[model samples]
Target chain A: MRDVAIIGAGMIPFGRRDEDTLMDMLAYASLKALDDAGLGDKSVDAVYVGNMGGGMLQRQTAIASSLVDRLNLMPAAAETVENGPASGGSAVKNGLLAVASGYYDYVLVVGGEKMREVTGWRATDFVATMTHPQAEYPYGITLPGMAGMFTRLYMEKYGVTREHLLAISLKNQEMGTLNPYAHVEMALDRGGIFDSPHAIVNNPTSADPLHLYDLCPVSDGAAALILCPLEMAKKLAKPPILIAGFGQATDTQTLQERDDPTDLKAVTLAAQKAFEMAKLKPGDIHVAELHDAFTILEIAESEHVGFFKKGEGGKAAAAGKTRLGGQMPINISGGLKARGHPVGATGVAQVVDIVFQLRHELPKNRQVQKAENGLTVNFGGFGNNVLAFVLRRVQS
Target chain B: MKKEIAITAYKCKKCGKLHYPYHDRCLACKSREFEQIKPQGNAKLLTYTAIFNLPWGFDQRFLILGVAEFENKIKAMGQIKADSVDQLKVGMKMKPSWEPIRVQYGEDVYGLKFEPME
Candidate 1:
């Protein structure tokens, strides 16, 4: 297989975009990526769109064909990939495969979801669909509920605390303030974060121990990436980001059936596979974009993915090791907590942040100096269906 | 009404795997042959949650109780319907009982809930 590279990446600001349609957001980001790649729409050979809740959120189906038709990319094959919240990452992986396997010279991958268009309660219900239909959903087990359970178990078994989880939110919010594309740019104080209005209302006791501030916001946004063979990418873009390694894994969908809820076995396996393929270790990564849909998730994920020893993730975050200018910066793009999680768009948006970091396009205050290697973790349905990728900056 | 709870599950005749609540096929062996089974009363609660909010159709009457390993070693979530939420804890022994979740149109959706087995 030929080597694949990301020539360009773009994302719409993550927030309530009721004024814009899904196609409008897709077009905005896709056009930006195309422009960044210095390629016209005619250069694209195929399109892959990732959307998890378009049918429930927008009452729209066959989103891929519709987007291709709207973009006027006639005769180009378009397909939609749905893998719960990891749809975006799945789409990008598929696009990379298509370009690498010689099926297409260039592939444009886009992921978007207008979650804020629906009522907050309805959106929660919609997101809850990702859980096991018979076991968890009927018991009023939403994402927050599941996260809370996992957090409780992790804390109990691994000796983590609410303070450790709070530190993650504080750090991400601080990094997000420097990001122009972040949804929540304001810095959050510890007291205010534990007592703020949004936190009080949204973070209310969804379940024991996990308050509202511990979760990510419902957001609307879209992200796009242009992928092509390494040879073609070098001619089009300056310093293309090479996809060094990609790995995906699956776990038991039902939380109860899993051997252990606190341990993310799928994520561990995927990361190990990716690292082996890339001939690198966790220490080689200079920056990371973790799927921090909840504050506790960032802590648990860091440990499960081998970024830190088990139970040490919370201490690492609390000590500011995961912050910018620290040992290894994480979530400089605010993460899913403060940056916003638009389900389908979250995975691609994470890669956008990595590309920016690798190309030195981020604001100086938040940029990781001498950053060369980056990794992204995108998971669907708690621990089920995890995708991990390692990217390296092409040195001239 | 005398409150009673039991661990309820759908047992697959082909694989003998027990599943909580109800399902058409056994997740373990992908079998359609199954029998409704309720393990004997009183089992340990593996974990739980005290939900402050209720979803659609659920009135603000009780806190949701997510119980595990009740009688049949099956996990399920249901309203406590108890007097207070302070009584719940991890590893607490509880009994499973039947309660009306809500009336959709005219059909009563029965939910499996757990009560303190003191």
Candidate 2:
């Protein structure tokens, strides 16, 4: 099989986009990617749309067809992929394979979710639909609840403290203030959020052991990427970031079923597979974006992905190892914590951020110095399903 | 009359790995055949959390939820019978009961509820 490389990457600012419909967001992001590729009215071989809640929230289905028509890209094959929160990553995976297999020369992969269209309660319920229908859903288990339970277990087993979690919250939010595309631009203060008496009102408990700041905000946004063969991408003016390796894995539907709830086996396996395929260990990665839907998740994923030893991820964050300019800068784009997780958009947005880093286009504050390789982990359903990708900057 | 737990656990005939919410095949050995068994005796609290921002269906301000393992090795999610999560602890003994955990369509929905066995 041929190698795949990202030629174009684009995304809109993430936040409460009440004005744009799901279809509109998809179309807009696709157009930006198309223009960025300098394709200038050229048609792609296929279009892959990653979305999770169009049917549930907008009462819309066959979104791929709608997006293709909206973008005036008729006659190209169109398909919509749904993999819970990993929909964006799954769509990119599909596009990568299509191009690598030589079946499609150019593929447009876009992921978007207009979650802000619904109230917070309805959106929470919509996300909870990913839980086990019989065992979890009927019991009203939301994603934060799952994270809260996981956080409790991690604390008990690893001795992770609230200080560790606070470190991630502060670091990511500070980075978010510098990321124009991030949903939350406000930097959090320790006194207002934790140290002061006003902390209770500023950071209330959404789930036990995890405060409001620990969770990503519900958002509406879209991101897109243009993928083609590595050979073709070499002709472009900018450095083409190669999709060197990718991995996806799944675990038991419910957390209780796993032998050890704290052991995110899927995360470990997925990252291992990606690293193996890339022929590079985690230590070789210069910058990374982990699935930090919850503060605790960033810590857990860091350990599972082998960036740090188990039980040390939390401490690593506290010591600033994961911050930009540190040993390994994580979530320079602010991650899901500050960038906002629009489910379907997140996976594509992550790759887009990595592409920006590889291209050396970002301002120094958000860009890693002399970055060469980047990795992304898109988690779904509380660690049950996860996708990992390793991207490398190929000198043009 | 004591109400039954109203839950069926499947034990892999080949691997003896017990599963709740019945899997089509055993996760361990992938055995197709299994024996149905009822959860026996009290349970041990494994992990729990009190969720404040509930979904649309839940009306209460907060709900205490947890996963507990029964004596028969059947693990499941249940509503913890406590005012606050402060009373819950991991590895603590809990008394399991089959009762109404929620209301649906103005009708009582029976499910698992765990009370601290202190």
Candidate 3:
């Protein structure tokens, strides 16, 4: 595969945009990315969108075609990629492949979800569709409930404490406060987590061991990125972020079939592949964006991807190792927990943050100083599918 | 009418693997040869979720229960009509039971659920 580079990245603020339609948000982000790249809509050879619930949310199918029409890129091939919450990452991967394979000179990748427009109960149903339809969905295993189960087991098996989970939230919120685009940027203390007004009102105990604050909010937003071959990328307005390594893997969809729920083998394998391809080690990475849909996920993911030792992620967080300005900053965008999880838009948003940090364009407060290398890990449906990408700043 | 909770599964004649919530083809061997096999013995609850919120078309009657390795190593999710969320715990023993999930569009759909084993 030819070397592919990210020429431009753009995102709408991660939060509830009740006034904007899904297409409106996508258009905004895509236009911004195109303009940033000094390209026009006609330059895009194809478009790949990551959307999981256009059908459930708005009863809108054929979303790819709709985007193509709305963007006025009629001649360009348009497709929608869905892999549960990992939709964003998968779409970005496809766009990377398109550019790498020389199939297109330039490709547009966008992820958007208008979740808050639907009723909360309906939103639950839409998210539940990620599970086995015949078994899990029929019984009602929402994502939070599954995370709750995982959290309880991790605590019992690994001695992870509830306070550890709370600490994860507190730290992410601190990072989120530094992030201008984060959905919930307000900082909170451990006591405030369980007793805060937000907790009392919106975050009632949805599941045992997981309060509202411990979970990622249902949000609506969009993120977009422009991909091109290495030769063309250097000509763009901003410094190019090279796709150094990319890897993806899948596992059994049913959680029971997995040998160990505590160990995300798919994530481990994907990360290893990415690191090997990049010829870089975990220590070489300066920054990271992990899929932290829940607090426990951040802990589990940090360990699974070799950032911290197993069962030591929580302690590392307690020690502030993963915080900004620490050994390796994580979720500087507040993560899904605070940045808001718009499902399809999450993966692209992670890449956007990486681009900003690598370009030294991020607000000084959230920026990681001299961030030259970055990684993004996007997992679909509780580890059923995972995609990992490593990006490096191209030295002029 | 109080009915005893039973665990039902389908065994593939080709791979000799058991599948929950019967299917036409065996997931293991991808074979059509199968027979209904009642999973014997009880299952340990690997993990569970107490859903305080119910989705649309679901009754506000019970908490959503997601159990792993239940009834022949099958993962299942269903409405668990237990007395309280405290009654649910990871590693707790459970028995499979069939209950009416909901009447969707005037059709009653029955699904397999798990209740705490005393």
The number of the candidate with the highest TM-score is 2
Q: Write the per-residue lDDT of candidate 1 for residues A1-396, one digit (tens) a residue.
A: 998999989888988888998888888888878888878746588999988998987888999888878887777889999988999999999998999899898898999889988776688778888877655676666777777667777899999988898898888888778777777887878766665565575446666777766778888899999999998877764689988888899987766666676778889988888888888899999999999998888888788778899989999999999998988789989999888899999889999899999998776897899899999999899889999989899886
Higher-ranked by DockQ: 1 or 2: 2
Model 3, residue A386: what's the lDDT? 92
Q: After superposition, how far is residue A3 of candidate 2 from its true place, in Å?
A: 0.7
Q: Per-residue lDDT for B7-107 in model 2, tens only?
A: 88999999999999888989999889999999999999999999998988898999999999998789999989999988888999999998887777989
DockQ class, candidate 3: medium
Indicate which candidate wins on lDDT. Answer: 2
Give the candidate order by descending TM-score: 2, 3, 1
| Worst-scoring 10-residue span by lDDT in model 3 chain A | A190-199
* DockQ of every predicted complex: 0.45, 0.83, 0.58
Model 2 C-alpha lDDT per residue in residues A345-367, reported as the tens digit of each score: 99999999999998899999899
Error of 2 at A2 (Å): 0.6
List the candidate 1 regions with Cα displacement exceeding 4 Å.
Answer: A195-203, B1-37, B59-62, B82-85, B103-106
Ranking by DockQ: 2, 3, 1
**Which candidate number maximizes DockQ?**
2
The 10-residue segment with the lowest total lDDT in model 1 chain B? B53-62
- Output the chain A TM-score of model 3: 0.96
